[model samples]
Target: MEDRKKDHIDLAFSSRLNGDMVDNRFDYEPMLGIHGKKDLSFEFADKIMQLPIWVSSMTGGTKRAGTINKNLAQACGEFGLGMGLGSCRILLDSPEYFDDFNVRPIMGDDVPLFANIGICQLEQMLQNRSEGELDELVDKLQADGLAIHINPMQEAFQPEGDVLKTPPIELLKKYLEKTDLKIIVKEVGQGFGKESLRQLLALPLEAIEFGALGGTNFSLVELNRSEAVAAEVYNPFIHIGHTADNMTHTINQLVDKMGYKIKVNNVIISGGISSLLDGYYLTEISKMPAIFGMGSAFLRHSMGSYDKLQSYVEKLANGLQLANNFLRVKL
Candidate 1:
């Protein structure tokens, strides 16, 4: 554990000071494009919804995580938003953990729920699992879609992180071709750029979650747990990547330039989305149908007391309403 902590710190420092220009380009316009004028209503695998805002993927391994996910699902159901569960790796690997992670009780048939798994874990599924086995996992949770998260930086920072051996684009294409369900291409903390997005767009994907850097700094998380060398390498770039606002704008612009050639079902603007205004601004500026908020701030107010959670949900709802009204008049 001590050595792991050191490795994190090294990776953090290296990433921060490395002086790499993080790319931020989108093929769509910021306003008045395919996503802006087109009807937001769309079918996500088995679920259909009018709103685009979704409760972004968080955690679901421990009891506390399960509680959080349950509350989040309830909130999502109430708000008419989509919801995604955290990585199912631990649960899939350990039956004991799976028994404890109860997401079904919180999910609703009407709500769009997505099951998440990492690229590294895809190898496990390919080894012995059949389509029916994978489908059973989603069926058990009543998920509407499957999200495959890419987080090489997160892994490199973590001491026990999986070494990403190859590019996942081919694997993702295979999964897309095989699954009869919606496949969401997501990033963990490091946001996606033009090249990566183009590659993903080539696949038959349902959506993209640009998990921009700003909210949760997993690199920093690893740094706190890392040691000498890794810490030094990754510490400087704590705020290394693009902000949520920048990423959203870029993606919107990129999608517009592409002339709506790629049928991206949704664009999830996550990371650093805190207050109602942040949500409002993101929804206004981006062409994507929805925005995702994942940090503890939103969850902190939503968990435990129903009234408190309701109030928090209302605030976000009001913000979206305001944005929609303003867009109606402006556009």
Candidate 2:
């Protein structure tokens, strides 16, 4: 037993956190009694999430897409968390792949479920005056709203890419006029800069999801699948744009500067967030109604059985509750 203890101590020494991680994030207080998970509650997307985390969109119309979507929806319904479906582009043309995206029935009516579509598709709909198709997409999904994901970087590297014809924000202005569905504008990866955020915040967006640089930048995803020469040339673009923390801080300051001019009051702080502590820190510092989102992290467990996702969410909720009780975000 002593030998086992010595081996464990050696392993712990190798994995110990460095001094660089030290900061005034949480004030240690031993006197307060430990709290239970029941104490934590998060209200977002017009419903309360049992946990303060979100199952951000991923895997649509791909292999085992139906299974992935169903599993994610079940977890969302069970945990009281919100979800967004990946690009509904496949469902736009036919009902053949509709089962892959039709997860609203599983996520239920209480927790918010938003249908997603790329900016390229939205541009096409606008140019053609084909907004009816989008309206139908939402109706069929029984989703609360639509999230227009802007992905210039991803599209740039994607083969046979639909090169954007018009400026996205301008197209968004036109798109909003065409449909009354609730909207949240998000980046695909390589998050918005100050000017972009400023432009978006000035509009009547329901929320902003920072598909920031530190996360799985879809630019890199597309590049990896591109020709070797093209991938090498475009690789540097992946590092561009803001982090979740940067975006959150800029949002707070910009809102303060813009005040009433800012039409947005909700945001999904996502990208590169690997833990409940990260979510709590960003959510706590946010100036508006906020919910932290994760793509790969949620996707990792979501691809498996329902129990896997459920257990992951249970830990996140409990962790969030503990953080909320003992830690405070330093403004």
Candidate 3:
């Protein structure tokens, strides 16, 4: 036992942390709050969640997608986090893969679970003037809202992509006018810019997810899938879009400018967030009620085992508890 303890100490001594660990806003003051007493729970989209980490939309419409979705739902149920399912457009025309998207039983009746669809799919529904199937999709899945993912670059790069006749903002505005379901506007991988963020903030949305640049650039995913010539032509666009930090600042500025009149009151900081610290910082910096999310990270964990996913979430919950007591965002 003594030898094992010495080996563990040696291993810890071999690893070194950098000076970048410093958060500019805080002092090394005496810790006062009891860790267990700190409230990590919050209300989002009419659902109360114990943590603010969202399992951002990633997979559906695949053979193994059921396992992944069910694993994620089970984790959210255990940890009290939120989930947004990947594109449910497949369910609109057919129920062939309905089980792939059905996860409410695993997730239980609570937690913010929303179905997702591309803007182009919604555009088609607008043209047909029938959102009956869409409403049914929500009702069947028992989702809290619909997340309309705006991904023009991804579509343009995809081989069988649909062209948009109108801009996403216009489509969203029109859809809101005629429908009553809750809406959440999100980017695919390229996060929103100042102007686009401004417009989305004006709407009464459940939340705005910063599908910022950095992690899983969907344009790059589609570009790689495209023919070599097409991939070369569209490669530059994969570098576009803002970061989560930039979007957080933009949301704060917009809220400041609009004061109390801004309709959107929540933001989901996702995309490039790779660690719990990034999640903590972005969530704290945003002026609105904010949650941090990850796709590839959660996807990697969920695709393996429920135990693996739960272990990851357990670390996150512990880190968040420590962060709430020790860290503060820079002004």
Candidate 4:
């Protein structure tokens, strides 16, 4: 106790925080709650996740992906978190990389595991009347559902990107008519605008993940892969989009105004959620059932040993529990 006090005294001067550094989003109520684990479990996509954390999709179809996915799935199983796999597009044409994305055995059947695919690929499948391939892919992986990521900006920037013959909204409206699979629509980085959100909310989607701006901008990724001149021309496009907080508030207002019209009842608050507090704040303020997801954060830890990934997820769970116990949103 004496040593702790001495260390606190020594660190006090350097630890002083000012106005801008203060997180004004929450009221830190020390008197109302205890510093102990609170039940954070919630039903999402018809499955229960012990922690409100989703390991956002990162990579697959590579030699290293098998290791990374195994590590991530093991962590999810141990921690009771949901996960979305990186694009399963490659698996549609060939089964050569199946093992890389085959983590259901490691992840178990309890928590939710989603298979991801791009909007363009789905559009092609629907056109070709090969949507059954999607079913086969999901069935083989034993994923709970499908997450369709829409990124026109990213596609436009890629040198060999697929050209969209029909608008994404139209394609989605058409595709929903055929599939019984629970669908989750998400942005790759550039989030949905108000109209886009409204349209999506009107659909019978399982969830809409805010793969908002302030995270990995796939448009920027494509630009970086392009020629220098082309990159410069399209650089400004990457900066356009909404952040997670902005989308959360927008959705809340939309829900207030168009209550019954909103069909999608759940959301995964992701993109630019840098820490547990960010996740807690957004999920608290959201009008719908929401959980937060992290991609780069989980990817970083998953690249190492399984122990490393487990430790990282443990910290996330611990921090989130502490936040839920004492912190309340200021709104």
Cα TM-score per model: 0.78, 0.92, 0.95, 0.97
Pick the TM-score winner: 4
Off by over 4 Å in 3: 1-5, 18-30, 33-37
| Local lDDT at 283 for model 2 | 84
lDDT by residue (tens digit), candidate 3, 1-331: 9999988899996777779975675544346555564778879888999898899997888878989999999999998999999999888777989999999998997798999989999999999988667788899999998999999989999998999989999999989887677888889889999999888888888889899998888888888899999987778888888998888888888889988678885888988999988888878777799999899999999887789999988998988887787665566
Against the true structure, candidate 3 reaches a TM-score of 0.95
Question: How far out, in Å, is residue 126 in model 2?
Answer: 0.8
Task: Please give the CA lDDT of all the candidate structures.
Answer: 0.69, 0.84, 0.87, 0.90
Question: By lDDT, who's the top model here?
Answer: 4
User: Which residue pairs come into collision in candidate 3?
Assistant: none
How does model 2 score by TM-score?
0.92
Clashing pairs in 2: none
Q: Return the candidate ranking by lDDT, descending.
A: 4, 3, 2, 1
Q: Worst 10-residue stretch by lDDT in candidate 4? A: 57-66
lDDT per residue (tens digit) for residues 112-145 in model 4: 9999999999999999999888888889999988
**Backbone clashes per model, in order?**
41, 0, 0, 0
